[model samples]
Target: MKKQLTAIFISLLFFQLSISAVEPMKPQEFKADIIIYGGTSAAITAAVQATRMKKTVIIVSPDRHLGGLSASGLGFTDTGNKGVIGGLAREFYHRVYLHYQDKQSWPWQQQTEYGNKGQGTPAIDGTDRTMWIFEPHVAEQIMEDFVKENTLKIYRDELLNRESGVLMKNGNILAITTLSGKKFIGKVFIDTTYEGDLMAAAKVSYHVGREANTTYGENWNGVQTLVFQHQHHFATKIDPYKIPGDKKSGLLAGISNETPSPNGTADDKLQAYCFRMCLTNVPENRVAFPKPDRYNLLDYELLVRVFNSGWKALFNKYDPLPNRKTDTNNHGPFSTDYIGMNYDYPEASYQRRKEIIAAHENYQKGLMYFMATDPRIPKDLQQQLNTWGLAKDEFKDNGNWPHQIYVREARRMIGAFVMSENEVLGKKEVPKPIGMGSYSLDSHHTQRYVTPEGYVQNEGDIGVKAPKPYGISYNAIVPKITECKNLLVPICISSSHIAYGSVRMEPVFMILGESAATAASLAIDNRTAVQEVNYNQLKTLLLKQKQTLNWNGKP
Candidate 1:
């Protein structure tokens, strides 16, 4: 009996020790000259530039991976003008080129067989020594190389305590604490998150959703009900009700019941989010699309209706990447984009955001599964979809699915200066140019609702071409001098909704990241606010760094 009791006591003691090992983390402190929040392409470039400038920087990332959408299946880059991309951004693509130069990089397909597939542009720019199109893993590897080469300090999986994280004094951030009880003190901070969490936490001014076209005197700033630039809209009229023509059957699974704001009006709606899936038709490297656990036939009723009505543009945007893989993005209406589902994501708590992200993942997975296996789909389309599957080697960590969701737009900062349509279209000359954007002003559909004509329609999809490469102002990055003196936002920049569509490219983010870091370092050295950095000196240093501040209207 005594032996038995002693054994139980020993087991209990061991269990207690195990519990202590998993106890809540105690607060720990770290100090750095510059602290960057968000593990994005912008964040990585910012840290790399700061390190090169001889400043101690730490990346307080709330992610396990470093790169954002760039490493997360956005391999088919959307560069409008390769000439405008320079500095660290161009270096990243050059590294991608070097990676492909090694013959061994071609695993599923030979380099010659893949040929040069890009969006009406050469994949490899010979003169620049940069390759714009690449595989998702290849992009991630390049970003990993940057972190490894710099030996930069990155605190992965450390989320900021949004409620009471930032400690500020006299218009300066003193320290920021993460939810895991890690506190980082820094002289200057940069927020490179797509969601602008750090900037929002610092009480910086920002705007979410779309602004009225009149607010900025921009043609593509708001509700674009009449604009149908892409073929993403429904090809024909499809009923949104669950029971086809019966309104009493209630609305379909994905269709919203709310009335859309008038054309060119502002609303709280945000663009749809999706996983830019990396898929492949190569048999050896393909993993069949798995039906999600929560798959419901009722959820995809609207899609079936569209298919039944003779929609055949489902595979339009399967953009080709290296290694026989494709960057499968949202193409037609009722596709991968989970419309009207992510409106609350910008300000959602971590746990809530996780739920939103998971929902998006499930939605996309179910979409692929339905396309491949659902008998309701046209037999020809089903057969074609069955030929493709998720790339087995890509996103291996998360069941062969992309780990990042495409946050097309989020909380845009309302800083000292906001880039508007006039500046983007070369109507107004921007002062103190730090970078340039040439991509067309593009905003994805924000809502899918029933139209007054008793048909389902998408709203808020806008695409307006910029006349030429335009300068991005330094003031667009830094907060108002009175709001925060030490912070810079690169990803969620201060811009009108229409202008952000042009400036939110990954290359532009990296360019702005480098410039922001350079400005931060100068500010720290000169003992001045980010807004007070001399533009002439900043411009000189940027030019010295080989950054392209203006386009000479040449390819």
Candidate 2:
């Protein structure tokens, strides 16, 4: 009996060993020619392009949904010089047009009832066969369609282990391990995230906040204490203190106490971030604005003052989408932008970033709830605001709130070429052009500070238009050869704060992604660094792919 039992135990041990061997030891590994680390529009475009180029590609995304802000309620496209948006970027818009052409795409409103309102053009441009504006779900569906059509492999919700996950050999990234312990190995990697997480982990040199004007010879790179270009600032003087004229009462919650430096000097402050909320007035599909748990009435004390000062432009930025839904953005100074609250977001740890995002969401939600129900707000304005609420059909899985925040600017790589206001304003030439941008050089207010005179005022809102559509350099997307040879950053390209204002649009990101993938493919085929890719050959392929390198007189 003892011998039989011993033999049975040995058999059981061998069976367990066989099972373990079959299970494999290392974390689930994915091998591909190109590894894109983002779920932004840029990631989708890059994956699609690489797959079309017949290269094995994988998107190891940190987001559960794709298309980043484009599918995150920023349906009103910021298409600057729509003609400059070619390649897969243009195809995405065309697909949006195709989706809307079908009657079933519009459920909340009829096609004829929804006027063709867009950014200075018709939303549906029949001549160009593209639709610039769309709903959030439609944009996300298009991204999913791209994934299906291209048969691209995507591992969603896999965040990069920022501390020590990047396995490097001779400055080339061999593999990256996610926090989930999944390892993705690739020949080339694309950092398409808005925050430049992979780029930062790879030890690429980057700059956050504003650079001094002298850094890039840029007119709009640094502090702008009193410069107001758009109607986003205080229309009239408002008090900064909780108790007017009382020094000891302390400044209101949103007002900063420190004095700003001169206009052209540098500071670590970044432009404010807000949710590009999808709101609608359709009774059947409207979900009333829910008050956040930590709602503080005092947080919006300045907004109460704005209302008392007769500020009535709350709906100025309620940009309409395809349906009755609106892409509500920050309009007046105290509307949606939680200024002076996100200075540490660019390099924050994952938990800290979550706290920041939660803080912003809570602030914005309280702002809306206050507007809708507070007696401090004007009755007319309150009634008007009560009509609008979260769109039920959008972001259904996430409490009808956008899953992504508008990370306007973050860690910009100081790469092989740094785009400045000079290049954007046409004062300097751009070499090895990959794409073009014509959006106004714009930045939202960075701070709401109490003036020396003890009055509340905003600072760092800029909107200088680009003279023309300017070329974006390919060198801007590649890191220095000494840093990391295999990685390409399309979203956070090397640019000054002001230059990034124009290049930070979603369509432009998609354009850069396609161009970056093309370069990555060329580099793999040539067995060279991204910086050493033959530009002449890259330009040829980019043009062949129908990317608008130089703005011609065509869309």
Candidate 3:
């Protein structure tokens, strides 16, 4: 009987050990020729190009969903000069065209009902077989289809262990371990995240915030409180004090009490961030904007004052998308952009970043709720806002809200050649052209401060147009040879603040992403560092892939 009891106890212990082994997660080990460390549109294009070049690639993304801003609420694509977008970037838009061609793709509205209304151009380019604008879900589906068709390996919800994630050997990244203990080993790596997290972890040289105008000989680089080119500025003088005229009553919330920075000087303040909300007017497909859990009326007292002071351009940027939806963005002085609240985001811990993201969501949602329901708002404006609601079919997993917030600018790699405003404005020639960017050098407000006259004013809003489609050099996307040998930074390419404003567009990012992957493939073939890749050979391959390296004056 004693022997039998001992046998039973041993059997139970073995069973318990087996169960524990299965329950606890072990570090997943993966190896590939190339590792792309972001889920942005640029990352997707890079992975696709690598696959096309017949190289093994894996995407380790911090995001649960793929396609960063493209899959987010930025459905109104910002394609500056359509002719300049090519290669896999153009292919992605062509796929969007194909998706819309099918009648089954339109569920909420008919194809005919939604006419061509894009960013000052037709939505569909029949000759090129590309569509510039699309719904959020459609973009997500296209990216998923790319992964399925190519059979690419993707690890989602995996964040980089920023402290000790990157393992380097002689300036080459050998492996990167995630917070979850997943280890990804690769021959070549690409950092395509908006925040340049992987690049920063790899000890690559980068810059954060706006550089001085004199730093790169650019006029739109630093503080611009005096230049109010857009209508987002204050139309009338309004008191910045909480008690209307009494300075002793203290400043109102969200208004900075500090003096403006001297123009043409560097500052650490980053551009504001906001959600490009996907809204719809269709009753069946609309979800009313929910009142955020931490909603506070006092937070928006300034906006109420703005409305009372004759600011009526609330719906200036409700850009249309397919299926009766709108890509609503920050418009007037106080809108979606959470001003002066994201200065620490670029270097914040993951937990802290999550809190910031939540705060932005809450603030924007509360703003929408205030505009639609608050009694202080003008009745006409309130009625107009009431017509729009979150698209029910979009972002189903995230309570009918966008899963990713718009990170307009983040850590920019200080690479071999830093593209500045001169290059973008066609005043300087770029060597070994790989891509092009033609968007206006645009920036949103950085802070709201009280003018010397005691009136509230916004600072750091500038929009200077690029002269034409300008070449982005190969050196811009590559790190310095001394910093890292095998890494490429496409999304956060080396550029001054003013030049980055034009290059930060989604199409431009995708274009550079494809170019970066091409360079990576060439480096792998030659067994050389990414910085040493032959520009002539790289240019040949890029042209063969149908990438537009120059404008060619087609229009």
The most accurate candidate by lDDT is 2
In model 1, which runs have C-alpha deviations exceeding 4 angstroms?
A: 1-26
Better of 1 and 2 by TM-score: 2
Tens-digit lDDT string for candidate 2 (288-352): 99999799999988888888888888888899997799988898888788999999999999999
Q: List the residue pairs that clash in candidate 3.
A: none
lDDT, each prediction? 0.91, 0.92, 0.91
Off by over 4 Å in 3: 1-26
lDDT of 1 by residue, 307-330 (tens): 889888888899989888998888
Ranking by lDDT: 2, 3, 1
Candidate numbers, best TM-score first, in rank order: 3, 2, 1
RMSD of each: 3.3, 2.5, 2.1
Residue pairs clashing in model 1 are none
Every model's TM-score: 0.95, 0.96, 0.97
Residue 425, candidate 1: Cα error in Å is 1.4
lDDT of 3 by residue, 204-287 (tens): 999999999889888888888867877787878978888999999998878888898898788988889999999999999989
RMSD in angstroms between candidate 3 and the native structure over all alpha carbons: 2.1
